[model samples]
Target: MTPILLIEQVLNGLQSGIMLFLMAAGLTLIFGVMGLINLAHGSLYMIGAFAAAAVAGWTGSFTLALAAALAAAALAGCIIEMVVIRRLYDRDHLDQVLATFALILIFSEGTRWLFGSFPLYLDVPAALSGPVRLPGGILYPSYRLLIIVIGLLIAIGLFQLIARTRIGIQIRAGESDREMIGALGVDISRLYTIVFALGAALAGLAGALVGAIQSVQVGMGEPVLILAFVVIVIGGIGSIKGALVGALLVGLTDTLGGVLLPLFFGLFMDPSSATTIGSALASMSIYILMALVLLFRPTGLYGRA
Candidate 1:
């Protein structure tokens, strides 16, 4: 591959990694602080996409659409927490998984009912629709670059939020000892709701941003959600720092493997066979990385023993 092509692929990897971080961050936070295994997290992602699509279509404003997506997802998360999730806090993991899985069905069917079976397309805003020249004479899509910037900014913001604020202290305390915090007069229930809604909002924002590039449709979030889970597992289930590192590692490995592996194989074999075998291996690269990591760390890079 040419230098420009390599640069582009690296950027693509970075973009993919950052987006996965957005998904995984919320997941890790929820698990770490609330001890909830929410299978319906992906449904929240889908809700964001649909909300953005619907609002954008009606208002013809991308900004407004994004706001709507965040609001809708957060509201939905709060409602679900209040009505169902709160009850599951003390339940076994199996029960939590089953209940959230049921929620996935409800969300999927409800979305289909409202949006019909067709996919919704979100147009990239006019201002960000074109490509920009990068440092190495490489032209990159402006919107994708924006995603990278936004993702990084959010990461920084999250770090600050969790490290510098009063809420952050409370969150950390809750994670360490929920019962102690509650005994000290903290409204643990309200805090849980806030964290859940915050997580949902993050997922929703990811879905909305990604929907502009990919088709907005029912079940789009499942594949991403699965990847997000891999990210958290590889990063360490309760570690945001682990999520960031793991996401970037998975993204780079997957993207580079897909491009470079085929080229490497083509040197020794027929182009067709090389392409097929390379693609297959490329798809499995991240899982292989995960297995290797687990073999050593077991609990993941940042997970506690």
Candidate 2:
């Protein structure tokens, strides 16, 4: 492959990874701070996409669409946390899983009921619809590049939020000792709701960002949810830093393996067989990477032992 093509793919991978980080960051934060296993997290993502789509269709403002996404998802998250998830904190993971899985179905059907089975499209804003030339004589979608920049900025913001803010300290403290934090006058329930909502909002933002590139439809978040899970697992269950690193690794491996494997096999075999085998193996590449990481570092790349 040409250097230009390879670089483009890498950029694509980076963009994908950044979106994944958006999803995984909230997930890691939620789990770390509240110790909740939220299977319905993907449903929140879908909700954000639908919210953005509906808002954009009505107002024709992409900015408003994003704000709608963030608001809808966060509000939904707060409602669920207060109504359903709050009760599940003392329950085991199996119960939490079953409950959240039910929430997923409810969300999917509810979305379909409201939005219909047809997919909605999110148009890139005019200002970002055009491509910009990169230094290596590369042309890439400005929207995608913006996604990367925005993701990175959010990442830095998250780091600062965790390190500098009073809320950040509370979140970290809550993670280590929830009961103790509550005893110290912190409203544990309020804190949990806030954390859950924040996580949901982040997931929604990811959905809105990605919806521009793809059809906004019911069930779109499930695939990304699976990848986010892999990201958290590989990065450690509660580590944002780990989530970012693991997401990039998974994103690059999945994207590049799909592209390179067939080419590599084609050099030694017939094209058709190469394509079939390469595609199959490429699909497994991320799982393989996850397994490799778990082999030696059972806690994950940045997980505490």
Residue 64 shift from truth in candidate 1, angstroms: 0.6
Model 2 ranges with Cα > 4 A deviation: none
In model 2, the worst 10-residue window by lDDT is 29-38
lDDT (tens digit, per residue) of candidate 2 on 161-192: 98899889999898788889999999889889
Instruction: Looking at model 1, report the run of 10 residues with the lowest lDDT sum.
Output: 166-175
Residue-wise lDDT of candidate 1 within 1-305, one digit each (tens)? Answer: 79899989999999999999988998999998999998899999999999999999999999999999999999999999999999999999999999999999999999999999999978889999999998889999999999999999999999898899988888989888889999999899999999999999999999999999999999998999888999999999878899999999999998999999999999999999999999999999999999999999999999977
Runs off by more than 4 Å, candidate 1: none
Residue pairs that clash (backbone atoms under 3 angstroms), model 2: none
lDDT of 2: 0.94
Query: TM-score for every candidate vs. truth?
Result: 0.98, 0.98
What TM value does model 2 have?
0.98
